[model samples]
Target: MRLILESKFQSLLLNWYSKNARILPWRSKPSLYKTVVSEFMLQQTQVKTMLPYFERWMRLFPSFEALSEANESNVLTAWAGLGYYARAKCLHECARGFVKNPVNSYRQWLNCKGIGDYTAAAIASIAFDEAVAVVDGNVIRVLCRLLSITESFKTKEVALKIIRPIANQFLSKTNPGKYNEALMELGAIVCTKQKPRCEVCPVKSCCKSYQKDTVHLCPHFFQVKRTCCTMQRYWIRDTHAFLLEPSTVGKVFRNTLQGLLELPIMTPQRMSVVGLGKLIFTGKRSIGPKDFIEQIYSPQKQVNSQSLMSLPEFSNCVRVPFDQRQRLACTGPHKRWISKLLQ
Candidate 1:
C-alpha cells in the first residue's frame, strides 16, 4: 500500500506541476551557468529579491570567463548592498576554478567552490534535466509532513534517510527539470510554514498530515532562547576627516570595510565623556586639548558630516551605545542591533 501510494503521489505531483509551474527567467530552458547562479542567489534569500540581482549579474558577467577575469573588489562592490558577502567571494573563486578546467556538465561545475549537495543537485536537475534530488528546507518540510515523521528535522542523518528515497521516487527520467521545480513549488507555495493551504495542495490527497487532519501538528518544531549583548561605538572626527576602522570579527560583516572614517569604539564599562576627553588629549597628541566630545547612543545616526562639522572641536567624538541580539526568526537565525540609530 505504501509503494502504491508513492507511485500515485509522483503522478499527481508531476501532473499538477506541469499545468501550474511558474514561468521564471531561469526556467526557460535554463543552462548550467544560469541555474547555478540562480541556485546560489536563492540560498536563504527570497525569490523576489534574487530576481533583479540575478538578472543584473548575468548581464555583467555573461559567461564563466567574464566572471573569472573580473577583479575581486569589482565582484564585492557589485554585491555590496547584498548581505552575506562571502557568497560573492565564493562565487568568484568558483568562477576561477571553472576557468581552470571548463566543463559543460553540471557535475563538473559542482566540483568548484561553494557548491554543496543541495545546490549541485538543483543545478544538475534544473539545468541539464539530470535525474538528481534536491533536499532543501522547503523539501524537508514537505517530506516530514508527508511521512508523519515526529522526529526532529534538524538532524542531517534523519533528513538524508527520509528525503533520499522520496526524492528518488519523483526524479523524472523524461522531465527531471519540471519534476524538481514542481516539488519545490509545492513546498514553497502550498506546504508553507505558517498556514499550509492543504485544501488546494496538489499532494493533499496522499499527504499523511492531511489524511490525519493534523497538518499544523505533524511537523513538530522547537524554539531556542536568544542572547543579547550591548556594546559601544565611537565616531571620531578630526580637522580633515572622520576616522573609520575595518571590522575584524568573524560572524557579522566579517572583513567588511565599515566605519570608513570614524571613531575609536569604547565599551559601556570604559566609556565616559571626561574619560574620552582625557584619552583624546593625553593618550593621543594628534587630538589637541581643545577637542570636544558628545555622548551619542547610536553612531549610525550621529556621524554625518553636518553633525560632526557643527561641533566645537575639529577633533570631535560621539559615543554610541548599541544592543546586539542573536535569535531565530521566521526566516532563520537573525542578528540585529537595536539602538537610538532608528529613532
Candidate 2:
C-alpha cells in the first residue's frame, strides 16, 4: 500500500516539476559546493532574499579551496545583516574541512564539519545526482498532508521513522536532483502550509488530506508566543563623542559596536531613579562634566532632581522613553550595550 501510494506521488510530483520547476542560478550549474551553500543559506530563509547574497557569496568564494582560504572576518562581514551568524561560521568550517581533504563519497562528505542529515542529503542528491532522500520542512509538510499523517513529528525518532522511507522510495535514480527539487517546489508553491492550492496541486489525487479537505489540519501547526522585556540605555556624550561598548551578551551584534558606553536597562520592576544613576555612573572614572553633553530624553521628559541623583555617571541625566523592548527570549541570548559614541 505504501509503495503504491509513493509511486503515484512521485509520478505526479515529477511530472509537475518538469514543467514548473523554478530556474535558479544554483540549478543552472549545480555543483557539490554550490548546492551545499544554497541549502545552508536556504534553511529558514526565503529564496528571493537569498538570491543577491548567494550571487555575491559565489563570486567571492567561487570554490571550496577559495572559501577555505578566505579570512573569517571577511566571511562574517559578507554575512552581516543576514542574521544567523552561526550558519556563516559553520559554512566556513565546512569549506575548510572539504579543502583540507577532498572526498568523492557523499557519506564521507556528511562527516565534515557542519554537515547535518538534511544538508548531506541535499548536496549528495542535488550535486552528485545520488539517489538519496532530502527531507526538510517542505518535504515533511508535503508528506504529512499527502499521507494524511496525524502523528506529531515533535519526536525525532518518530519523524525519522515516518519520513526516511518515504524519501528513499521517491528518490529518483535517474535525476535525483530534479526529484528533490521538485518535491521542495511542490511544497513551496502548491502544497503551502496556509491555504494550500489543492486544485493546482499535481499530487492532489494522491493526497489523502486533500481528498478529505483537511490539508492544513494534517500537519498540526504549533505557535509560540513571544515575551517582551524592557531595558533602559544611556547614550553618554562627551565633547568629542559618546561612549560605546561591545555587548557581553551573546546576541545579534555582540562583538561589533565600539566605544566605552553605558546604558541602563529598565526591567519590569522599575528601579529607583537614584539606583539607576548609581548603576550608570559607579563603574566609570574617566568621563567628566566637560565630556558630557546635554541629556536627551526619549519623549523629551523633563529631568527632575530625583532622576538626576539616580545617575552616578553624569551630573545630568537624559531620559529616553522608547516605545517598548520586546525580545524573543527563546530565540537566543542578547547583550544590550551602547553601540556608538556621539559628540
Candidate 3:
C-alpha cells in the first residue's frame, strides 16, 4: 500500500500485461462500440465460447446503425448459442438509443439497460480512458488475496467496501485502462481460485495473502443455490425428418425458435426419469443434469407431413417440404429425442 510498492506493483502488472495479454479480435482494434459489444457478450459467457459468436456478430452488424436496423428476431438469431436472451434484447434497444443520440459519459452508459456497474466501468475506462476501476469476479479474487481481505464478494456491498479501494489505488494513472485489464488478467491466469501460482505472480511480494500463506482462504466465494428446471420441447417433423415450423397449433414455438423449425414445447414440466450417460458419446448430452444423465426414450412416431400440418398446431407455421428443409436442429444443448427423429 506504500508509494514504492504501489509503483512496483503497477509496473510489474503493466509490463506483464503489455507482453502477455491475450490476442482477441476486439482488443486488436478497440473502439467504443467494439468494447461495449465485447463486454456485454462476455457477461455469463466464457471467452472461448463467445469468440466465434463475437466475430460473427461484428461481421453481421458492424455498426450501431446496422444493429438498430435489425429486427428482434434477427438479433436473437445472431445471438444463438449465446444464451441469456435478455442481453440481446438490451443490446438491441441500447443500439437504437445510441444511434438516435450517442453518449460519451459513464452516466450515459449506465442509463443503457444491459450496461451494469461492471460493464459501464469497463466501457468508460477502457474506451473513454476514465480513471475508474473494473470490479468483476476476477478483480475481486485478485484484490481479496492481494490485500488479504476475508470478506465474501457474494454481494456488491462487500466488494465495493473491501476491494474497490485497493483496485482504484492500484490503478496506473498513466494507463488506468490497461492497468484494470492487467489486474483481471493476472487473477484469471495466476491468482486462480485453486492452485494459484503465487510464485510467478508479479505482485506476490506485496500480496497480503501470499505473505501470510493463506491465498487459498482469502476470497471465500459465496455460492448461489440454483435449482434445475426440467424443460421439454416437442419436435414435430415430417416423414423425412424435416421439422414443422409450429405454424398453426404451435405458432407460439416459432417466436422463440427463429432460425429452427419447431412445434409446441412442453418444457421444464414433471420429468419422471433422470439418469447418467454411459455410452459412446460420453461428453455429448442425452438430456438431464450437467456432468450427468442420459435417458434415451423412443422417438415418437409421426403422421404424414400434410396430415400433421393440418392439425391445430401447424396452422400458422410454414410447412416447408421435407426435401427443402435442412436437417432439423435445436438452438441450445442437443437432446436424444431430436436425434431419434433422424434415425
List the candidate 3 regions with Cα displacement exceeding 4 Å. 1-5, 153-161, 240-263, 267-301, 304-330, 334-343
User: The CA-based lDDT of model 3 is what?
Assistant: 0.67
1-343 per-residue lDDT for model 3 (tens digits): 3777778889988999999899999899788889888888988787888999899999989989999998876787677567555677789999999999998777889898878878888888898888888887788888778778886667656666677777777788889888878887897788887799988887887888888877878788677554333333344445554333432211233233344434334322211111122222212321112232323232244345556546454455445454543323334443233444455
Rank by lDDT (best first): 3, 2, 1
Worst 10 residues of 3 by lDDT: 270-279
Model 1: CA > 4 A from native: 103-110, 154-158, 236-243, 251-343
Local accuracy of candidate 1 as per-residue lDDT tens digits, 1-343: 8767766777888999888877878878677677777777787567877777788888888877898899875676565444455667778887888778765455775776677777878877777778888887787788778877666655555667677777777566677777778889988888897888888988887888788777777556454333333334443432334432333222233432332113344544324321343221211111111222323332323334445434444234332222211111100100112112222
TM-scores of all predicted structures: 0.71, 0.70, 0.77
| Deviating ranges (above 4 Å) for candidate 2 | 155-161, 221-228, 231-247, 251-343
Task: Supply the TM-score for candidate 1.
Answer: 0.71
CA-only RMSD, every prediction? 10.2, 10.3, 6.0
Model 1 Cα displacement at 31 (Å)? Answer: 2.2
lDDT of 2 by residue, 69-145 (tens): 99876776566545455677788888888787776556976887666777888887777777888887778888888
**lDDT preference between candidates 1 and 2, better one:** 2
Candidates ranked, most accurate by TM-score first: 3, 1, 2
